[model samples]
Target: MATEHGVHAAHGSAAIANHAHPLDPLSAPEVERAAALCRQRHPSEQLRFVTIALEEPAKAAVAAFRAGGPIERRAAVVAIDRADGRVFEGRVDLAAGAVEAWTHRPGVQPYPILEEFADADRVIRADARWQAALRRRGVTDLDRVQIDPWPAGNFGDPAEEGRRILRGIAYARDADDANGYARPIEGVVAVVDLNAREVIRVVDEGAAPVPAADARYDAAAQPRLRDDLRPLEIAQPEGPSFVIEGHRVRWQRWRMRVSLHPREGLVLHEVAYEDRGRVRPIAHRMGLSEMVVPYGDPSPGQYFKNAFDSGELGLGRSTNALTRGCDCLGEIAYLDGVVAGGDGAARVLPNAICIHEEDFNILWKHTRAAGQTEVRRSRRLVVSSWATVGNYDYGFYWYFYEDASIECEVRLTGIIQPMAVGDGPIPPTAHRVARNVAGPIHQHFFCMRVDADVDGGGNTVYEVDTHPLPPGPDNPHHNAFAPALTPIRSEAESARTVNAATGRHWRIVNPSRLNAVGEPVAYALLPGETVAMMAGEEAAVARRATFARRQLWVTQHAPDELYPAGTYPSMSKGGDGLPAFTAANRPLEDRDIVLWYVIGVNHIVRPEDFPITSVHRAGFALKPWGFFDANPALDVAPPAAACDCPPGECVHGHDGHEGHAHGAAR
Candidate 1:
């Protein structure tokens, strides 16, 4: 890379050296003397130097001189040198003069002026012999005669070429920054004729000006370029399942079904049993003891016997449940095109089911319809026996058990999107904090609150607070475990305490608090319910229940039509039709949902979580399920077919040569 200054140096040195003669091998005095003499003799000329080899040294030299003003006469001569260093100088002989004279001819002149020709007649006459010579050699254009002249042996061309050369020189000179002119000289000349709407041509005298019509020419304008600007179109699948109606569903202990309607929309329906029922179904009669179990001691199959014969269990409402027990079984049968089949037959399978039990508190209530008590009780006991059947295979399982819920006893379990380590924490200094966290974080003197809604609709709610504890390994099951757990505090005590981690004092406040670790908790309150149980190791406690709820919904109620075949991995098949693999059933819409989540920086850092730190939250919304009819690209109509004739051929006829000749002339 040459620097700007380096370029300037190279150009300047070359130009000077090309115009000057070297004085001495190495002598200041000799160099100065030669420079002085050259300048004195040709004050307006810049001298250049070049070395030439000689056959022998000679004492003969010639001195050339011109007598004219600055605008016209210029001449040159050479002096010969001898081995003795003696110089012989005189007027150049005839041979030299002939060479010089030839160099001075019209075409050979270094600076020929076309306007100086008295008329075009003089030019035509002077070039007549040359033109004839060219014609004899089969050359036709009189404007293209070539000639060479002088010791320089430079070539010259006809008058038109000379004019074009001069025009190019003028353009270059005008464009040169050193000259500092505003626009090309030729362009300025054209501007003078702008009002006349005609092109101005420079011509020698005695030549008639070419008519504008004769000189007119046309140029094809390039086609206007266009950009393909279009919004991206997302293809949606067709079918009832692809619509919003496909997303609603219902669930029960061992069966799940969609509430279908002719037009209104789909609804959820589920069934469960209580211990007070009078009649029960035999496990063997229902064929409930054949299912496999995946894990856990005592096995779900062992409990099926007890649950089938004894009316000791109760049924409760659960937000999360799978419909595999009924819907899945139906779907398999439908695929096989069977209405019903014998027991143990491949087509006769139970609905896909996932079951789990939680302790209930005395505050809970259980009620059942009574008219057909025998049938209902029989169905419950019979189905309960199948809780362990097919349990080990991992499709779906049912549970029949009993227990009591303790106050503040929060059972955290639900369907949650798969997560990985080092994936959840919000980085500090994010531009937008509130929109990212699952919910807002609330800060106070001694505690921080985390609040997140299940979805934008607030159907489910999650909230938790920070407590102080010794730093240790985090619990793997629930993401709640942080190295340090902040100690829990009463509202009054929290207001008075200063956060040790952040070295900030806290003050009592209602909903809003300063130095809060997480955003203030907020969730949709179910109708008639005031508060939900909150418990877990700090972080785990807040998200576990919500995750569990989401799981239940996905397993039991998600619409089959919306998530038809090929949409997700299969979970079961062989004996009964069902996909064998379960997928993370999370749905995000056209735009991802944002969650604002915050947790304590450390167990002791209360004020640090203040102002709420944010982490991004995203979920997918259900979309239509199907394939596009055709490839989006290349489906466009082909451009109108083009004619085969060459451009201008049709309009100009077979003598298309005429159009080309005219175009070339321009």
Candidate 2:
């Protein structure tokens, strides 16, 4: 795979042409060279690299490069001084072989690396106090204990102040590969100082018996299996519909560039639709900027359980190596992702992103009164990736339809965060999944960043809501209604929520570009299945992730304003990302703006969600409103019959009915 992508690891031996695109993710060679340059700057000190990835070029520079100009490659490096626990942020100019900038950011801690996590596990298990706690619960098999390192969130605890801490959750496993979450060792929490590389404290309140249900979800655990299911195959004999060169993809009327980020797993750049022989821009950049998974239980061990997956753990670093038939299907193309490990070394995650085409049933259809029918099948190009963040797995899929509509779907399926409970009445904060296994209530909030470049950059956003007119002369029959378009003029005003009663949707229109009817060319953003953050404003998570409270937030474009929950959310205090960005309430009229849309999923644990949870989906869609003069898929040709078995010889009719023709006598 490295050979296929020309990603050599000789450290600066590979030319920059191997990563030519301005927005391309850092390759293996580039990551090595960048790390080497950082090491050269601090030759004597030991540095623990947290994140190393492409320092995306400015918007103007990327646009210029797309217009056949040159680009300077750079990498952003975040590391911590192991000796002093000081955080340092640096930028390396790979083109010039120099360290462009290095600054120490005080009052903050970078995300813990994999190496620290592994070391913490060793540090905890070896601790005499932790071993005593396990023995108190009648578990003496040290090898069977699983120490899961979690971010020690800032809760104003004096002992945790100014310390790089990891709160460990203990689980008992039957074997090496068995599901550890099923048997959570309650009333025990291990606090480890990562810099000290030792267990700082071990709290054992009261031990509860671990659940002993048959939680093994693999096929080997099942005694019986379904044998009646038949095989179904997806074949695109001619090949995939999309063409890819470098990291850019072109499918039907869609054109976009794809990149994998250490923080944002899948990023789509310069997303545009080709219309009337001209490629027009829709969004300059699109990605999941931040996500917060906050458990609702207020228990001592569960209250501080909120996790900022992207900012704290990094989605790209946790991305799974997708399988062919399982993760994707039908003439698939895979992209390898390169991310920095704890030592600043390049770690290539093969098949991190999957690209394929899906049959969406139908695009458009019409049946005439004369018994003639015309229909066109719908096919969409899907760009997706999955990440296993601790107990849960998340799949991010971006779909590009031939009709010029875009959709982003997130699928959640994995082991629920389990807790051990006694045979008393279950707590309101949790549901009993097994005999003594309880799953806590939690919410997953995802913030999507869309840098709107709707026809061009000079765009305005309007909240369109359907309102029925008052019963009067204007509505004689009391049935007249119209869409009330409200312009989001200022940053403060742009912070809005979804009003399902009004059928609310936001429209991004380029005021400078007019459609055929002399209206602004626009696209509408339709949200889906959103639930508000149940945490109050005083809650640490609500203050830190203010963007989750509202479904939509519009801010004037700023190069540094990328993440919704600020740069470092590992142990952040609060009020940094959207709240800080929109504090000034800048005017957004006819300006280059970005929309931060939050998609929330409220998970109330169900009995069926146990063993292994099925996929729960939530997403949003972007449809061309006034951007297209008419139906963009009108020119799509109808699908041809697969087999040439003459009319009566085939088992199915042209309309896919068994042993029958359309409009035939029964």
Candidate 3:
């Protein structure tokens, strides 16, 4: 697979390209070289690399490229100690082939699985303390324990120190079966502190009450199972309707370059559509900024289930190596992703990104004179990727429509986190997503950071609100209404909740720019069905994901302020990331701004979601509010229906010589 993508690492040599494109992720060669340099500087202690990803080029530097300036890409590398939970940083100058900076940091928690697994083995390997805890839970076999690692937050306790922790679960894994979720060790949670690299304590939060049959998550144990159904195929006579030049895609009127990041997964760059004569700009850059899945169960061990998937763990790096024909239908274009592992070796993730064109219902249809209907079928360009974070597999997609509207969607599937269901009735706070397993009712929160450079850099977030008018002279009829748009003038006023029933939408527009009707040219964000976190205001999850509290949050653009939840939010206390970034209440109007839109499902687990849940999606649209001159697809030709003119006699009064030019005989 590495050879296929020209990224094959042979022995001690790196096969990654060292060239730095604006949107390109960190290369293996850059990482390998950077890690070697960092280790040389810190010769005393052993360092294990954790995250080796690109420190994205700033927007200002990116903007300079429009004038044909050189863009330099840098790599941000982080590593942890093999013995103690100490964090270190290494920054590499990719172009100059040098390590730009190195720093030894404290208080930053570690997340590399290798470090935790090593530390956990030291403590829980036939240790008398953990073995006693396991015996109380009725598990006799001490050999089948699977130690799962998680970040240990400081929780703002003045007495507590920062480090990593391991949650020990029972392993029911077999060579042929893939139901690790169903094999949780009931009634015992081993709390090993990696900071101390020893067993500090054990928390005996007994498992959920249910029968033993609930643990059967194997395919053969599935209820209501039936034989495999008939085969279906998606055949394209003309092959795929799109062209993939490297990772750049061109489908219908859409044009964009796609890449996968270690945290953002599928990222679309220089996204635009062909409209009228010229190519117009849509978004300079966009992707899933961050996501948080917080469980609602309030037990001691459960309340801390506010998992920040992207920040805490590299969700983008966890993308599944997508399978062809099964993951998508029709002609698909596969793109490989490259990432550096803890060993500092670049690993090639093949088919991590998928691109295809899909027939999307109706674009526009009209019954013309003589019942001559002009109907155009819409075909959209879809760029998709999926990531599995522990018990959940998340799918992210970017769809570009012919009418220049962009849709960003997320699909949640995969097994729900299981608890040991003992012999008793399940609790009321959780729903049974499976036969006997209970799924704690939780909210899946997603925040997308949109750098909507609508008609260039200077833009304002104009909020349109529809309100009921009073019974005065202004409203002669009782059904009269009034609509107004208030420009978000300051950061303090930028945070807004979803007013779904009121037809509310935030328009990103440049006040100096106007359309044909003298209206401010803009693009509006239509946030679909979503649920914010229900945790208390003072909760750690709520504080970290402050951007999730509202539907639309706009702040002055700062390249460093990328994630809504602050950078390195794994074990952070409250008052960081967006909350701290926006506390200045910076003026928002007529300035470069970044908008964060939170969208997700209000998941109350249904019985059918067990074993593996089907895909349930939530989405939002970036539509041309006043950004376009007119309907971008208006000039698109209608689909060829049964034409009355018939034969080769020019379908809609065009000369049949389109395929040929009839000049002189020459």
Candidate 4:
């Protein structure tokens, strides 16, 4: 991030068509040049590719004084030598226009995890082995069948042996609803080793048959509408409330740069909100670090289905090109993302990033003792991206508010994963999402990495709790309460939980930088849509993602400790990421720190989830505490009342906050 006007600007090199800043992605030409180098190295031997992404360069100290470390130009390319199945990592310098460094990641297949899904899907369509399993069910119209390969993760299995494998299921689809898995052709499973490019195991119970898709319970189809029930269109002039300048977006006083990452979906960096005439730093960088979706029911077919969404498979790599009016509204700006294809070529996911402003209904309001009123309608700058992982679709959105707070949210929608529970009552372990389609109960865990450079990098964790004061001489009534603010002095003490009952919250404060009242400039961790991972430490699912164990883990800053769940968790055994990082119990107080905040959903499927379900959001906000002198947005006056009601009449009503406990972690 380049510093201008005492504010750190959003980082990005604007080399593409309509991009604003350089969240630092490799240009198509740069990636192509790197791929040519890999091909030149492989020459005659067949090579399988993994990832070719921007290897961030180290930043200089003067500019990166707050967020410290590398922010230079470099690219990383990973590929597998198929002749011996060896994976190689290549680093290229954009300035030199050539490969500057190379290394071999021994025993690990570069593109083993995700590419297998596509390979498995292709084999089922082209090969005869999976075709035979389909023939047994009397389905000859193979064109109508959709073979979707799911991530069959290795659960400490010794048999994996560094090979790319995928488990596939077939679904009968007549049209593309983005919910192809809704119409499940049950009682069939295909185990494919992508390295071998063959279906190794075919599970056909024969007891259960493929459910009929007679269009009666089509999940994607909308109900027939007559010449009635037409709604009025809502429009806002002034084009949009936000403006995109390079990779950066400026909405009111909130300014943040958006990055298109290969692993992390939508990364927001150089985040700072303007308060009055001065600018203050909120978060230097933030995004989803790692995620795990662990299924509850563990049978022969379901046990191996836990997905390390970010680690095993790349979320940004699978991002879908968003529709204009459907995905975003008003005047919009789109940023295309480039990812390494299966052949190590730079593939474009068009309209991969969407930047726009959303009307959140209200910002803030107040009433006077006299017949007077004041209110402000809220609008937010939204940076979003969508990714489809097998049966589920996740839309990652980062909302920047005028109040100087940033909300990181994940919207979960898409077809539910249908099971072979033919014509029976809803199973105890699962809930029926569609007709005869039992969607297994599961949990989606997401850890957001927030680098809060409150005033600078020297930050401390402060836990504030409301405690009942002892009924002594001072407290005549037993109802007296005292709020205690405890600054966590160690890393081990920072592994805390979100206590919903009490007014419990955590704050990342730069103790050295104090506000006018002599308090540290800080941002409060206001809990958002919340759910903890249910899998215990003993479970294989826990072994896959140790970060999901706690809701919050604060670790002293180390450049190498980037991922919470270790990198290469596809066929990994265990003990690499968060648990291993925290085991040393490193010093944490008043140091540069990274806060891993976990938020999720215990997705107990309901019938409403069918037919391309509604968005289930889980997130939290980094609210300004003493970072602002007052309500930073207070200076900006609200828009005039547009309704017919009298001023201060209906205005007394809440600004849409009823049961919404702004402080509740739940």
Q: Highest lDDT: which candidate?
A: 2
Estimate, for each residue in 224-290, the C-alpha lDDT of model 3 and write its tens digit: 7777998777665556767655555677777777777776677887777776656666677788888
Q: What's the TM-score of every candidate structure?
A: 0.15, 0.94, 0.89, 0.88
Candidate 1 local accuracy as lDDT? 0.18
Give me the displacement of residue 55 in model 2, in angstroms: 1.0
Runs with alpha carbons beyond 4 Å of true place in candidate 1: 1-666
Per-residue lDDT tens digits for candidate 2, residues 1-666, read 223323231122242255478887888888988888988887546687888999989988987987989986999999888888888899999989999998989988878888789989999988999889888887777898888888887788888888899999898887898987888888789999998998899988746687876498998888888899899999876677677666777888899988789988999999999998999999999999999998988776688799999998899999999998988877778787889877778998888888889999989877663334566879999999999999999999999999999999999999998888888886799898898888889999999999999988688999999999999988999999999999999998989999999999999989998888999999999999999999888898888888899999999999889888899888788888999999989999899999999999999999999988999999999999989989899888656545343345433235643434423423
lDDT tens per residue, model 1, 137-238? 333433322111001010122322222121110111211222111111111111011112122232211111111111101132224544688764322122
Q: Which residue pairs in candidate 2 have backbone atoms (N, alpha carbon, C) closer than 3 angstroms, thus clashing?
A: none
Clashing pairs in 3: 210-422
What is the number of backbone collisions in each predicted candidate, taken in the order shown? 82, 0, 1, 17
Q: How many clashes (backbone atoms < 3 Å, residues ≥3 apart in a chain or on different chains) does model 3 have?
A: 1
Task: Give candidate 2's error at residue 330 in angstroms.
Answer: 1.3
Could you tell me the TM-score of candidate 1? Answer: 0.15
Q: Compute the lDDT of residue 138 as modeled in candidate 2.
A: 73
